[model samples]
Target chain A: MTETESPTGSTLTIGVVKETKPGERRVALVPKLIERLTRRGLKVVVEPGAGAGAQLADDVFTEAGATTGDAWSADIVLTVVPPSIADIERLKPGTVLIGFLAPLTNTDEVAAMKKAGITAFAVESIPRISRAQGMDALSSQANVAGYRAVLLAAQRLPKFFPMLTTAAGTVPPAKALVLGVGVAGLQALATAKRLGAQATGYDVRPEVAEQVRSVGAQWLDLGIEAAGEGGYARELTEEERARQQQRLTEAIGGFDVVITTALVPGRKAPTLVTAEAVRGMKAGSVIVDMAGETGGNCELTDPGKDIVAHDVTICSPLNLPAEMPVHASELYARNLTELLELIVDTDGKLAIDFSDEVVAGACVAGRDEEVN
Target chain B: MTETESPTGSTLTIGVVKETKPGERRVALVPKLIERLTRRGLKVVVEPGAGAGAQLADDVFTEAGATTGDAWSADIVLTVVPPSIADIERLKPGTVLIGFLAPLTNTDEVAAMKKAGITAFAVESIPRISRAQGMDALSSQANVAGYRAVLLAAQRLPKFFPMLTTAAGTVPPAKALVLGVGVAGLQALATAKRLGAQATGYDVRPEVAEQVRSVGAQWLDLGIEAAGEGGYARELTEEERARQQQRLTEAIGGFDVVITTALVPGRKAPTLVTAEAVRGMKAGSVIVDMAGETGGNCELTDPGKDIVAHDVTICSPLNLPAEMPVHASELYARNLTELLELIVDTDGKLAIDFSDEVVAGACVAGRDEEVN
Candidate 1:
């Protein structure tokens, strides 16, 4: 352990590393967060260009009292995504690595973490409870993705989102249909509504209709309820799926823009917009599939590509949160800060209390082997 | 005359030609308007792929009773842009060519039209009066350009336009500053407001402050009045120009988006956003120069390109109205239809009433040789 003691006390060293994932433009921490951490008696070491993706220059971090250096020697490291195998090898034994570590699907990384004897906390594993709401990084990032998806659709769509009466005639507002009512979906609906688009939202869970209405968007009732545990939609029955698809196909044809955010966690995103439905849409319409990374909710969506289907533009963008990194980083940094307070004790020492529900739930590796 | 006599009467032939200007996507008439023309006992002919840029397939025009043929042989030829020298040569004598002929700037085209003996009506020459409001193509096209400029800025901007309140914190709304309060500038302000941006506008004319305030944007007063004749800003005095530049340079630094639409009709667009002003703007801020074609208002703007200067993305788009061809065409076609009604007689014969103010103002050639 590379622990150093100051005259006042032993300060907890927090390291921020630049994301290595291609097209990942968001940083785990920003310059504003550096002062907040330093004020809490924590020493921050940021790798050069770590916050460049977020448009936060290295000098800005230094101005906020963060030291410019190689952060591999720090006690705790912060990352937005799962670190590469090479990066995992750089960490010292017993070093704590924190991020959206997918311990369920990334078994290889989990095994490597065990071999390296490094403690790992997955932000994705944070319980969706009232107290942990502020620490929910997934929800924070999803909010950004949701807002960006509407803009992408608006930019791609040939028509205006709002209606206007001019000397020539009145141009009607664009009709938008949003699939799913999660954090990302709600934000998309709110953004579309704000842009003056007549927005409608659909979710498998019937209870989210009220949330959709709260954002000034109409609720699309499919007449089927599939609300699952933990606020996720359950896998639908064959009959229910067929009926849902039929209703969506008929309803989606009337919309000028469609934003799909339906995801089943680690599973493939459900097909909400079929090829026939896309063909039925008016020419020059736009569809933005937010769940493109794990197989899109649209049948015709090509991940990371803008494709035209029957004259309708379908954009399957990956890492939308990264595209607007300034605010994205700010939100993510705050989430990590809240989570850090829970993981660290008052003496500036790492304390993983297994008895604490949040600690037990978010702990992916480091505790005795019961993690997925 | 290429008039074909039907059993009912001798019908007028209205021809639509493809625009030759590079990056010009708008067609003079869409398929939707073809039916309106044909209903007035008029024969409609469309050149192959004339409406393709506007996403209206040739079959759609044919379905609306328009025949695919060479438009040059028709008595009345409609175009979106001024005809090329070669196109002028193809026109028969007494042919009526209608479009936004830059009568003031294109001296060669005006002389060519006179030599060819073609009756030309420039849409840009249409007088801005109450009765001619429906025929104002400049205002119609400029409206589309302004709305599109905001969308372009929003797409390129790294942050959200609206004030978003999330669990992490509240992200303040993006501040947008629009220079000039013409039809385009006003539309841009409204669009930015619709997107939830806190928009501010600056104009040399003091009277347009009410127009800016009407769109819910704060009026930026440079304390120098340069309101000129015909509703355009006059040439600013050197001392007044200096004061305006100084105030703008300081004010522009605070805005996230700056849209400059200051154009003096025939003269080179006034340099509104200087290089020093651009350098003072925040990094990742956007500047959309709407007066790009008539020599940009921003010093750093390279027409038809997106350049980053002092960390600010300056987009000088060429033909923004063409990018949104669907509605742009609809509005332009309506303007042309209203203008056509004034020039064409009740007996379905070509008649140029030089005594009518709308006709006299719109006529660029054929009302004696001195019209150009």
Candidate 2:
């Protein structure tokens, strides 16, 4: 066996494992990143068919200097979704696991990883500092989801998104309204504008108006300010919520397409498009709820299904990023690459530096004492 | 009784009938057009539920000055599709009928109309002259099909149509190519370009290169010219066809999306994307064949279905314009309005002037002698 294969070898081995989550098509790593890791004197091990969902074959990874072998015993393990309890039992002690570990929600899984002595770094837990921008997988995946949501809305709507002056007559451009101003909402507005739609954005936090305008979209302000800590809008009060819904119902009637992405972290998605709002909209209008997995932001939204209510089509597709596997995986793999560069030493050995805010913020388990 | 109810009255009455063809969602007129027709001093009657498919309610049509009643007994009948044998039997003798009668192919339907002594005007037979441009239903419907085709291709593509630069990385825009730079092809290229794709156009007729360039798309020339009369490319010779296919195979592989709209009147659509070319395309690429009803331009296309072949999605959607009923019906109604102006006198009486070129060309049956 090669010296790199030894359990206590100096050379670090990064293992790429296939995602086991149902309907999850993205991979933790891609073939192009294999060379980036290998150039750092790290040996890369990929499980068979690891990148199949992302359209990256095993032969492509092998051609990029990766070996097809058992990846579970490597020094560093990469994944897309949180590992199952059975998968946690398979990990060796002191293995550095990198992925979206869902540390805040998957309590049992976090406890199981601690029992297994796996040093878990949740990508979602990465501090949203300027330095950790490149390692933010949540933002990267949300960007893809936002772009795909507009295309889905366009496909279901019977009218054209862009204006065209033809021989018969002139067709007016469709009006698109986005109900959130985060990364996904901004990207959705930008994409809708690119397709020649008249795009508008709304958010509880009034500060995001400039960011929305920067993407060539007008901002709809309802005079509510709920800017919470950590870049998320706080839950609105009962009176404010009622007033917002009433204003939104009136505003939504003027739009041909409405994309709702409002979410309160660790809580159910806020209902921005009430059933009354849906009724107010035009017959051929469409609504794409990006927060479908979080119980949707529309009252009429049937999570994970396409349904028509009040003459409006509402598509609440779960895991929208998985539908576009190629680009989604590429961006996620890049995020992992940036994070790996921080935790791996120049000499190709595993080194955990808790002094760094990103490492300290992302680490949830595996220390002499509890780190969570 | 009203003057329009009298058989020998000077007043003229027009009837809008519901389309009976399966999958045809468009109507001959919309509620918005009722006022325009009423202003011409003509009585209008609409069959119940005629505009329902286009999202136009019966109350809306009634509010616009149209009466719901027996439309088949009106002096002139307006429809979107050719009347079936049973429908033709319902028409009054010497009644003026207007729509896409498919005179060139539906011989049985034309014979039935003639046996019933119905004066049939085929919208497809309208002369391609400046004065008749507003009455060209084929061009109007084709434009809708073209715009929808790009949307279909964009929806199926795994990558974004436009280039996106995010915090994680930069994604290049998709390259789209359209075959047959006719009205539909030009619209497809323009739509793709609007969606921020690198668009290209190719046609057998070299004269359309300027038209393609006007849509902000580069034209791909295979050095084959088949320009024919009536603004359609003539059938190519065997040698020319083989050479064009070979060159197209090489060029099509480089595009992320391909939309084919080539057709030769009554002939089957020419194969532009061969099976070999599909195999050469990258994974997750998409192809939309607009000529699915006439046999697709892609060799592997399954007409009226969306299928995956050689890692490429080939969508052969039939009656694409029907999918967007609102705009399709609106445009078609405008075309019929322009045609009605040619036949209806200012006195609000039936006065078919054979001297008019548009009237003479569009007339298919019911005369002292056969006009065909």
Candidate 3:
């Protein structure tokens, strides 16, 4: 495919940089997406070793028509995470920075972008509206975390996931309980079911019982509903929390594997399994705390460590999406491409409209000098 | 249930001991089988922590009518692996020993059993007849290994095992190859298929092509059959080996995950995947060398360690059954129970008929002092 497509000969230069976040292996874009952007009259430049973490070689990007250059010098710079302050200073004014910027919690990053005159689009801030569903990086990444959590649990569990009948005897299937019915929880439930486990899911929102059943998992009712805005679970009241805890403590003991994915945006994850509950679980049971990085939902979960408390193994895996970099980057890159298609015009110029809900929601900084 | 049940008032004592071999965590018996044996007029004794590795607590064993005692003092001492010399010293004359005694390979252990006057039954030496299938410990453990191999590969590979379609895009299913059609290889093929991988299996014996296809895997006919006696693959001639390697090197490059379980009795495992073949694999692909302890099927596999060669991760896990001790012990304990039932009469006394083929095949050391 040729790089020049527009008759006006107008094109934009886009840059892809290697992420510097510790243990973050995913890239914002891959070579396949670079080819797609370049074929549309967009000049693509990738920093050396930009795709190394995702097992993509530099030569492969070059082969796909991406040139090696200083990523900060391009008209638009793409990254998976927020860039370092030193890297951000290298970008000239009017440069657009696109990434999974945690705008709600990263007050300092939004201020720096505004002061530097860098228009930034936070992919995490993509609205939950149907129109912006294709560009939702948070949901896409969480899907990967959910799938990985099941694999991690299956590997750590002392028994087989599926039931099997041999000449010697028959083995019972493992019972898996997924806490929360978000994108990650749904995926975890589906993955566990696919592995032949008897998957059960719990969510405070009673409405999600159908979604849980749709994924072939039984719904766990704790008799307390905490449905909140934006499809997230609300913080529970003191009395509701005690009731939920009491019910879950008794139910958790029966499961061989437990995966907790209850994370409230910009806040500590709700405690699902307390230390006393861990003691109640069977000896060979395993718990995968998916929200470990944001202060786990399991009280005994030690973030980024595997602990055997009361004979139950608790694996608090952090950054699961990064661990499966190939698929994670592929999904992230596609999300970036869809978002770019929305904001970049046919002439390869910025076409941001303040009236557009997606633009207004995801735009953390712009020419208006708005910091938030 | 009472420990004594037979009208003759004779109850044989069967002991369960903790395996002393390094990295061996499986127990010959579990609490469930203890209840079964005790109900059948078999007095069960267990060493302290005998089933701890298998997640069967001491209280559970006692609840099943088993008493804590020196395992060596029982009428029959059961183990997963051969007992140590120090343990054998504690056994009185005429005590029966049972385990997966690799009699053909471990000449020293066989001699030790004969010299100590320990009548030993080798589970590995059990006849492959249909009637003796319940006593096949080797096949039971291999089944666990095969199932675990796919889980290990899915966890290590940087992609999803099954094909997935989401709002973002579609992920193709992982391609898996099983090099062997034995118990382990068949289980691996079945597991890979269960996980939604497109699986293919290869075997030197053409008769097993149907068995491979039955497990939902495509049969790979290498066009060179080396079917041997006793259900094992025969060693290939020099020229036959060259042709097989040539064809496999080309075929192996196409798979994302390769599980090799080709093992010849009393011999080193065949080299199915060479170093050159690993270089031909995709960067994020994985190879599980199931025969790691007996010299791996992959040339670069380091037994009990994971190595990355040519961007392909090679995992040579040893004793996968021990890693999932709960079911491993359950199957093993049942196998031991079935074997014991064959030798012990209803009166709980030894019934060694020289004409019986099952006993003749499995008896490694007996009153005749025959060691081998």
lDDT, residue B336, model 1: 90
List ranges where model 1 is wrong by over 4 Å.
A1-9, A369-372, B1-9, B369-372
DockQ of each: 0.69, 0.69, 0.74
DockQ of 1: 0.69
Instruction: Note the Cα lDDT for every prediction shown.
Output: 0.87, 0.88, 0.87
- lDDT by residue (tens digit), candidate 2, B166-217: 7778889899999998999999999899888999999999999999999899
lDDT of 2 by residue, A1-372 (tens): 011223765678899988888989888888888888998899999999888787788998999999988888888999998999988887898788999898877999999988888889999899999999999999999998998899898888888788867777888989999999899999899989988799999999999999999989999988777888889998899999999999999999999999999988777999999999999988879999999888999999999999989779999999988888888899999999999988886667666778789988999887544344
Question: Per the 3 Å backbone cut-off, how many clashing residue pairs does candidate 3 have?
Answer: 0
Per-residue alpha-carbon lDDT of candidate 1 for residues A267-330, written as tens digits (9 for 90 to 100):
8989999999999998889999998988999999999999998989999998899898888888
* All candidates: TM-score: 0.95, 0.95, 0.95
Residue-level lDDT of model 1, residues B18-45, one tens digit each, is: 8888888889998887766776667888
| Model 1 CAPRI rating | medium
Better of 2 and 3 by DockQ: 3
Query: Alpha-carbon error at B165 in model 3, in Å?
Result: 0.8
TM-score of 2: 0.95
